[model samples]
Target chain A: MSAPMDKPESSRRQFFNGTVRGAFLFLLGAATTLLFRRSQPKRTVWQIDPYKCICCTNCATKCVMHPSAVKCVQVYPMCGYCKLCTGYFEPEPISLDTGAENQLCPTGAIKRRQLEDPYYEYNIDEPLCIGCAKCVKGCVLFGNGSFFLQVRHDRCVNCDECAIAIACPSQAFQRVPADKPYLFKNREHQA
Target chain B: MRRMLRACLYLTLLSLPLVAAFGVERFPPPEFDAGYKMPVTTMPPARALWLSYVDVAVLVAALALASYLVLKKRSRDGVLALSVFSLLYFGFYQQGCVCSIGSVQDVALALFNSGYVVPLTTVAFFLLPLLFTLFFGRTFCSGVCPMGAMQDLVLLKPVKVPAWLEHALGTLPFVYLGAGILFAATGSLFIICEYDPFVALYRRTGSFGMLALGAAFLIVGIFVGRPYCRFLCPYGALLSLVSRFSKWGVTLSPTDCIHCQICDTACPYGAIADPMLKDPHPDPRKRARRRLALLALTALLVVLGGWLGERLSVPFSNSHATVSLAEQIAAEDAGKIKEPTDASKAFRQTGQPVEELYAEAHRVRGRFAVGSVLFGAFVGLVFGLTLISVSEPHERNVYDPDPADCVSCGRCYVYCPKEIVRVKRIQGKNVIPLTPVRGEQKG
Candidate 1:
């Protein structure tokens, strides 16, 4: 034998190792089953807390869908109702016309309607929106931060792991329960 | 043992009521106004209580099959089939979350975060394989692990890394495990799961950088043969350490070794040890004396490493979100940063006390300091062991698999002549005892 071939000592070590392994397994098994039982009703849906979003333009590219499910939503109460809406019009628009060149949304998802004289109401066309967050950034910077991104559940495949959540830079994506999924940035939202 | 089991049962029972009490609360009211017609809500499919149990059952079955194939059957083909199944179920079907590899972080996080209740699946994923490995010598690694399976499938051009280079590179897993625990314990991130290469492939979507990293690992695996498992998998490091004392293990042959060297080249992972009967070094007594001194030095290094780690904990603590936020708030206060980012803005709007945030950061940093000392000691211990194992080479009279390194892939069985004879004997064929042929005996 290369080393001491004490059978009793070797057997003792094996017994000790086996005991430790058994004890660990038993404890882990208990904890695991408890956790599983506890997690039964805990279903989570992917969502964005608009207040935490950094508008990094990742929502457009990182989403698995060709046209991202994330869409820009207008918080009407938070809107300043500006006639020269920074979100609807380009940064250096020649005029606030209905021309494509003057439109801020790359896909023309934001529709500018004159509610009254010197005030325009902007509504997001969800189907046309790519969630690039360009308008959200523009609005947040220059106007009342009314425009924000939210995951459109209608189009979402509900993947086990959200693609955009993994890529989100500011870690804005969260898993809120299915019942109250959207963390909308509204007038009531403190932040 | 009975007492322990009873205590565990009681504890689990006691915790159930608490779990139910804090169970899913009422969902908050709708964000939109009464006049606004909410879009039809598409909830994630209700996770049935039985579904999680099904996953657990599948996992248990797979482990059982893997152990059977590896230890009893010794069929590489069976192992491969299991690997393919694991790749399909665990990798593609489940999308690689709650994996044994990722569970390392969950366990670490739970240990540190007393309030954090680890998901049951995470605990199961972490332990079952380790338990199997302790008994059956890394049977889980052979085929059951989706990460290993993915890499195994891509092994096209196998190459033998130089022994010294392999030894040096093998140290990386320990460092990786230490860093993983450090990050998780500090609530910095689950870097292991975040960087898991095969997970992106399973999901069929992720950032370009992560996708590229996954592709790069697979490409490297074509030549390196489970390079991630050997050099980067923190879980693999844990398995390897525990597998050293495995009760049952793989053998190169069923019977005596004929000193044939074919099996030596068979193992892609370089787990086979080529025995040398003679002492390679002169002055055995002197070497023994030197070894004792080295052991003392290793002990010293462990203590010194812990001290150094404690000193460096502050910088390491920056990875934690609270610490980073605190530093950012301080920077903004000092007018060092011109503009506040979204996180800072959100924090300011929360109306939470800045002093409380600072205290939280301080507390996290203090924990990191303690965590770092343990991490440092672990690293130093690994370093000392590596040096000592190399210095005190064991005498081996026959070719054998190194228990610590062997993944039990069963590649060596086919190369062994005795194993071939045993197979023939089992199949009711005439078994011939080895007698040297005239030409072969000339040497």
Candidate 2:
């Protein structure tokens, strides 16, 4: 049955609800304004700082994305184009041939082609690259350090906290402006 | 002679500053006579910044529509349709990143770390739902939140959890929120986002453990409505607090209650409060005594919680990478461990003083000590308040939706005979009383 409540009591409850609602609204407004003022106007996306990367291979497995957004990038201008390209061939190979067993990249992402009698050009097959940083380690160690890893924005969902960042040994992952998502190795130091 | 020369070169390369050698060019590109053109490395464009704004716009529109459908239209069908759209757009399409649930960490990080600049979209994602909950109750939970919608869509044969069990389990979100904030503020982790069950499903790939967690929640959701929303979502804890003071909320019946108790069973979340027949404790003196006792118990709980939390600081501090790294390095130096972890090797390669790393770790642990104490105290306060409120007498006179627990999913609308009559009357159908009038039944 519909029980009749005293009008004053009902009105008092309404007044209390109204007062609380107003107070809550005021608090929310203050928080919103403060947060908005503190926030950056520009949006950010996760990127990898090429310089600080230690090629620990954490990016290959730790990313939330299956294949990871990270891929090895080749800087052609700084390439030595050596016949025994360290980045393309395993440390000790039977012969410097394009054999799967001798390839430095587990996924065979690095493609080696002869440019001249003594020079060879290495290209990265982005789709095949697992971001394991194998070739990057090789290049950095013995070659011209032309190979490095970068987060491909198209494949990246840009999680608020990048899983790979947490797993990174060298703390190389960072947030860069959405407008400039990728960090490239500069040629200034390469003479 | 060649092998010896190679050995000498290797030693020199190793001896050189390895960090500085990263971008060094020992050999230049070979000049080509065949006019070979170098293919430029292509950089993929990031997700458009305007798309993030569009997501915010969609969120606002969905929340507004959900509130209207829940409060004004009181249409369950409309709310369900909206929930499906939210599931697709926010859950599947956007892949559950930048969600309000995860945005809690972003806000915490931004507030504590001056270096962190939370994006405008993230702040909007964090605050908009709370603002709406203050005015319109948790309409966001009803049909707008993808996580809620994911669970809502999976619900089948719902089973009621025991009130005592529900109350105990309900405290988890607050504890989780505390840990999430503590870790995020300290720049340690985003535990909420890291442990998010549904995000793995949305992204279609994750660590096997995460995928299993998502699957478990979905399976559990089939029998228990919105398990994540009710017991695990930190954002829901915040929304529930705001919704307690909400101005307007979903009503069980459009007109008046018939005391049918149909809405009580209709609610999968058990959010409908039945009318009190009479006061449970009529004696005022006994009531005051019980209240005082409960208050004392609450105070004790708060102290115990805080003390326990402080004791946990050392273990909790290990969650921070630097602290764990420092410990690892110490263990290595002590010969307790032989192999250096990748992190330790990287740290050593930086040539930073071990003492500096130890000092940083100490500073972080100090922050965690303070943070854990506050976290424990906050959890204690929530538990104490919950106990006090549960014991408090209610003045409710009708089958009213509990403002804090009701998701405003509009499930109870059709169950109310009064609501059914109103719907039929609106359709211009010849109305027949579905049940005998309450007054006539006694006569």
Candidate 3:
């Protein structure tokens, strides 16, 4: 306790022990390499964020792999198809045929569900939806901002770097504070 | 074999002049001419680089490498080695989520905003991947892109794209490609930008629709890696054709495979087309029916894609195009505030009336929906054909080379065991790099 340099272990023994430690480090490195020949690091990614989305549909169109990186998910309770659906078509549709020739959604994503004889509900086909937001633009510009876009975190890499973020024109994309990231629609914004 | 090699050499030599002279370059207008009269379609500069030299070099390199790797006759590791590297380049570097070809679609669509197509780069970008896709499977998806790369990286586990769904969804991208191109050609519209998910996601900064779409894909990719490429990438569909005849691809070592599912676990991409399906494509009557159906579908789509392209095109360029009253107000306000810059005036002088161009906003809405359905139908047809006529799946355990998507990232070379052998090439030996690994070592 009195002498800091003094120890039960001898200096020669300590040096040899250090050499052995170095040898172990080398072995550990080699062994680890062989064991993990095909191993890669795992990263935590997200499903998406709802806030900050301006309802552009790049998800549907931009995905390189096909089908796309984007898919439309439903928040069914929020849908209300006014005669003028900003997310569905231009403010004034020529006719209400529900034909592809009339609607705003590129992939026939916004399916019109009849709630009653007059009141119809618009629904998005998550599979077919590319999130290009032709409908959203139409909706926001003319009718209620019911339909919006989101960054599905699940599909996102949460990359230490994000590719889409760099290319975003609106600078709408942002990193969610890692703890709790899903920014759903605000109560007032829903209207 | 020697003759083929010589022919390749000759092709490379022949293409050199074309590349140097034609590679994408901005040439000054004719010295004597003060006129704005320019060629409607100048030779796409990049085409020279791509068609002549780079493509030739890539093809030669890929073929030679494939032969050498095949001769290794070692573990399924060989396939994984190359596959992983290609996946990195295509998926990561290229930001696989955004389709460059589709950007042409977007650029074409920006007619509403008076964006003339940014030529040379646009055409070359669109066509290069397509050209590659014809012979190689959508290898662009596996390695040389970012969307697929993101999925590949994010995937904790991978599954195969379901047969029916895969077949149906797969046809969509081609329809998109064809229609997108057609619309661009017609100078009518580009719906690609109109429906860009990433752009929207980026613009709005946050999203519900885009998030949902991204989430769904992530989930799908987790279950089935490269879900977009196998079932949805329009470019992938195009590239699949090119990759079909690819000289070398990720093939398993038949003898070494031992039906040990380890490689299956190791290979993130569900590319190991089960040998059961890999049996040589079969049957005459069924095949004939398929051929007939394909021809019919192709005809239907070509007409449909063309008509849709035309219809879509009219919205931005047609003088009689519909414009919403609100848009008219916005546009009028914009025109007033804009003060007709010299560039815009010049732009107007080169082409049609500015007001006429502005009047087509109404058509933008219709083009998207119609374009989607038509494109979806086409995708369905393509996938249906693939499902029915499945053969030469990644039965062998080595990676296949795809020019369309390959960015030439060397991740797989590093991971490959035999890459350590240092295979020789006449020019010089390509040394394989080491693989990158995550945090604490497992051992």
Q: What is candidate 1's lDDT per residue for A44-99, written digit by digit as tens?
A: 56788776677878899867555787888887767766666667878778977879
The models' CA-based lDDT, in order, is: 0.75, 0.85, 0.44
Error of 2 at B370 (Å): 1.2
Candidate 1 residues B1-443, lDDT tens each?
53354335434543454221111111122243334443332233334436666878899999989888877787989999999999999888877765888788777777666665565666778888888887788988987899999888898878988888888888889989999999886778777876888777887876677789899999999999799999999999999987877767787652367887667776788888878767666688888888998899789889987988888899999877778888999999999998896567657756688999899999998999898998888788878877787777675667778888888888777666666667778778875535422222332
Best by TM-score: 2
Candidate 3, superposed: residue stretches over 4 Å from native? A1-191, B1-101, B104-139, B182-208, B254-269, B276-443
Using all chains and alpha carbons, the TM-scores for the candidates as numbered come to 0.78, 0.92, 0.38
Better of 1 and 2 by DockQ: 2
Stronger candidate by DockQ (1 vs 3)? 1
Candidates by TM-score, descending order? 2, 1, 3
Q: Taking chain A by itself, what TM-score does each prediction score?
A: 0.79, 0.88, 0.62
lDDT of 2 by residue, B385-414 (tens): 889887787777878788888999998876
**Poorest lDDT segment (10 consecutive residues) of candidate 1 chain B:** B19-28
Task: Give the CAPRI class of candidate 2.
Answer: medium
- TM-score: the better of candidates 2 and 3: 2
